[model samples]
Target: MSQHTFLTLDEVASNLKVTRQTVSKYIQAKELNAVKINKSYRITIKDFENFVNSNSTSQEPSISYLRKTKNCTLQYSDKSDDFEVVHGIFHGELRSLSNNGKLTPNKFIFGDNYFVMKKLLETHRGKVDLIYIDPPFGTGQDFNSIDEHPAYSDKLVDGEFLEFIRKRLFLIRELMSDSGSIYLHIDKKIGHYVKIVMDEVFGYQNFINDITRIKCNPKNFARNAYGNYSDMILYYAKHRDNQIWNDIRESMSEEKRKELFPKNHSKLGYYTTNPIHAPGKTLNGDTGLEWKGLKPPKGRHWRYSREVLDELDEQGLIEWSGNGNPRKIVLAKEHKGFKIQDVWEFKDKGLSYVEYPTQKNHDMLERIIRNSSHYNSIVLDCFAGSGSTLRVADKLGRQWIGIDNSTHSLNVIQKSFKEDNINFELLEYVPLD
Candidate 1:
């Protein structure tokens, strides 16, 4: 709560002329003061400023907080370029895939399309980059009663809830990138078991991060476990390597960049670089292939052969540091904003209130999408309650497909977006004749 100004790990590492790992080491050693989310790290400006005001600072980052890279019970088998959706054992089809990639959904439809997720997923197979669901989390009944728009309720029993989630998750997995991810937002009553089941389906190794999201603002209840200040977000990456992520840059104080990279004329600013191994020698580690003229770092093995280093030096991707161990220059740019943290503060947009009773913040989804999905990548929200994901997709300039089955839910979602003036690819929703 005290972090007023935050600096991302990459920024801090860049400023310190050190690796992110080193920066994290410093945080762990208490040589540096910072806040750490599950996998990523952040530094408060005040703490960093105070430390800098005192003296020269370069701290080693702690090894803790690195995402556990355990293997899972996963085997790669090619199905198709698309996702492998498991057809629902008990089935039916509605306007199932209409809102998928064709139209921008506005609200949750009132219908029993849950059984159709598997079949529907195959349509857009291998399409969605990220999936976030804030399905019913309360102990209430799910009904088709008139005027009770958005259709489902939290009143379903845990057994039924598990089934609901189990069925959908099967289809959801088929739709994710082995490098993609999913965020399941749920409450405590079922959060524990839900997590276990998620591990079972997504594989424990794929588990990314679990966040407790506080949904209520004004606390009305008393005597509880830390109050109902949050719900849970269970995350799982389809694959660790190759999962897409980019450096989120932020504006650096001109002073910071200048101090880190002196005389660096590259538009990325004064940055450091690594050296290419000496010519006529092979780099160890990688192929041990020899390069003609570049010398490798002392004691350290070269990663490439002599021929490869010569080729890299020619390509200009390899900028050399004066030292034997070449400090590979990490290209820098005058950043305007740093990448966001795993812990997201809620953002109240027009859709937040109308999205879903449990709709999450747009900024939150943006972070997930930014880290996981690529531009023009299609996102699917089967539980597209208030169209938060759809709206955010439109705003982010990405394609999307939203599915829901409640007429009331659909009306609210569509109306909310229309009122907000959010543009979408409108699809024809034919009615009963």
Candidate 2:
């Protein structure tokens, strides 16, 4: 491996934005190292860099300094000191409810997620691979079940609500592995503020996509605004480039199949013809050479080599039009599914069809879990309402941890898991002195 150049004491002090005396003090205290060169002191770049957390409260300030120096960052009141208040002393224990003589990775914790997630840091810090949370939007209203039973309240609004989510986010960031990703689903009314809060906690550099999800059918309400039919999901990764991404695609619908692949061959079935020549000319390659007394179209080149083009023709995979123009035949059945876009349409079921209030559609959970996580990875949902995310993770062969405070949510989860014959350890949070 290559090594960094050495620096003088004065150079190190200037780089650290501190006095030479402070740098000397750190060197004397062995927090940082320096070599005695001739009559002066010199420090290696690595040795000069080891004094990061010697005086600060945490490593976050150093990270913040580097980020600010390198890129633009968002700033908000109470943002710098917010984590200091919430990140301390988690006093709780995991009480396993139904273990089958083995320690199961899947867990269902019934408690306020703030303390429960902090408690999880002891065992799960930097271990979770994916998290999908559908937290209560700051609507300042209480949600009720179909029978008029109270489900949960979304009464916290504005700054208070944002702080509540922000505190949990700080702890959630600790639980996420370097390769982990989190998706937060919220309504448009408060989604924008939540995005800013997320950028603050997860770093603006790690922010990924603002996915618009069609949550319901179009509405014709008497309100002045346009019909509201969608919500947003803010996706962020612990580290942008390291996050797991499966690149799952969506299957083509019948209408799309008919529109794109209208022609049918007796042996090959539904297919469409694409131009054999693509844009951009190859100066001196096989793609520029003549084939079967025909040259590629002007200002373009053959999509394949001359040998491959002949093979395709021999295999009857090339279509010749009446004007003697040749194109490549693409079969619909052999086509890979279309790439999924940022906008999605997965409507939730009506209230009467769901087990709990605001229960999300399982298909949406399936898509998220399949795309952002892998089999056997740990998936977490601290704001698990009806346990849709946990259930979907189980179905997808991922170990999951679900936490919820509402008794109704817990009851719904228990009933759903029991009916589905899914085995999981149920834990209740107990405070410690």
- lDDT score of residue 372 within candidate 2: 92
Give the alpha carbon lDDT tens digit for every residue of 95-170 in model 2.
Answer: 7667545577788999999889888988998899999999999999999888877889999888888888888888
Q: Could you give candidate 1's per-residue lDDT for residues 351-411 as a string of tens digits?
A: 3334345456777777666766778776667777767777787777777766676565667
Off by over 4 Å in 1: 1-85, 88-91, 94-110, 141-151, 214-221, 247-341, 347-356, 420-433
Please give the lDDT score for candidate 1: 0.58
In angstroms, give how far residue 279 of model 2 lies from its true place: 4.4
Model 2 pairs in collision: none
Q: lDDT for every model? A: 0.58, 0.83
* Best TM-score among the predictions, by candidate number: 2
What are the models' TM-scores? Answer: 0.54, 0.81
